[model samples]
Target: MSAGSHTNEIPRHRVLAKVEGPLKPGYETILTPDALLFLADLERRFGRARRNMLEYRQDRQERFDYGELPDFLPETAHIRNAMWEVAPIPPALRDRRVEITGPVDRKMMINALNSGAKMFMADFEDANSPSWANIIEGQINMYDFARDQLSYTDTARGKDYKLNDEIATMLVRPRGWHLEEAHITVDGRPMSASLCDFGLHIFHNGKILAEKGIGPFYYLPKLESHKEARLWNDVFNFAQTFIG
Candidate 1:
């Protein structure tokens, strides 16, 4: 839907993603039929809630602009004060003394993965330009990275690049819920950029990474409230069950 469009009028049916941009060479592997369908499923399931949350964010910002101050919600104080422990840190992420982050371009991915840092975060959010070429190619680069098949050659400099033997553990940072992937639409509405980035990565590489003893990890960005965080947690749960 365009800005200010009616959200409730949208129909729920067979979910599909129509590519609105040029499908370049080597993109078919990343934008595979199955992958697109998986993305559609994600959008169909959670896209509306994401948009609602974004609306709430805007409304909250407007309130702040009108001199409203923030405060902790008393309604959830019980949970906050309750003693709880987070899940144990996975072995691959335990020693993160040095973590490097970079955009998802081929050269950058190869360089960062080999940068000797304990963790390398491939950022698809603010660090990346959301051009059609960049978005699609980023998926391809990550797909290859997970499978240990990524390589690049600088034809100008005649320099070949490849992953080092002792490379950093990889994590992905998807775009926040506020953004839309305008290049792909489902039910005549653009899919969430967050879903596009996270869905594609998890669809293509989640199983592969799980087999490697470290499940797919992510650095979620720009969450406004716990509701948004819960949305992500729900997405994670749904994707896990769907993929399994």
Candidate 2:
């Protein structure tokens, strides 16, 4: 479907099961119909490959368990020897001397962004509890942060919090491939937590972040091999094209 046509009227054929849980207030802001459509599309396009890659990981683990040693891929010797450099770093990420990371929560996010660090990575992986509430609320926190509308007030502590005028560049780290988001399912199977996290964030914030001259910056985690990284690159390219 055309990007412009992805509205609240997501085609029934594309709908996954409605996210299962007591979705908290403001959850609707991030879990809109169009956003879910975007996620469904991602699952359709890449889900099989994700599953296969996970299986390959298991196979490798079995081989290692049998005492087979691991080494660099002979197939990529040319790539190893070739001179190359990644794309130029985005302006906002160039001076990342100090980067703070933490799980997503309003007060912590506010502090992390305002910390004098050059970058703040809001983690949905190891640092986070993967409860359904945490997963969905993390997305909500990111949405508000991207729009400069994130703040927290601790009435009992008599403290108020808001972003500093010059806040750190925000980056996101999705959950690893080994994890599944039980709360969101596609075609009756658990959704890849990595894709769910990545898709929702990018679909909701990609353009807005671009307009702010920052980015859809990401910190990929728990990749076991070059193949996994390649898969992620493909996912990123497809999402970029879809959004455009």
TM-score of each: 0.91, 0.90
Error of 1 at 134 (Å): 0.6
lDDT of 1 by residue, 159-240 (tens): 9999988889988999988889999998889899999999999999999999997669999999889989999999999999
- Which residue runs does candidate 2 get wrong by more than 4 Å? 1-13
**Pick by lDDT: which candidate is best?**
1
Across 1-244, the per-residue lDDT of candidate 2 in tens digits comes to 8777656775766785458667888889988888888887887778899999999999999999999999988899998999999898789988989989999977999999888999999999888888888888889988987788888899999999998898899889999877877888887787788999999999999999999888889999989988899999999999999899
* Cα lDDT for residue 71, candidate 2: 94
Candidate 2 displacement at residue 33 in angstroms:
0.9
| CA lDDT, every model vs. true structure | 0.90, 0.88
Going through the candidates in order, what is the number of backbone clashes in each? Answer: 1, 0
Q: Candidate 2 at residue 202, lDDT?
A: 95
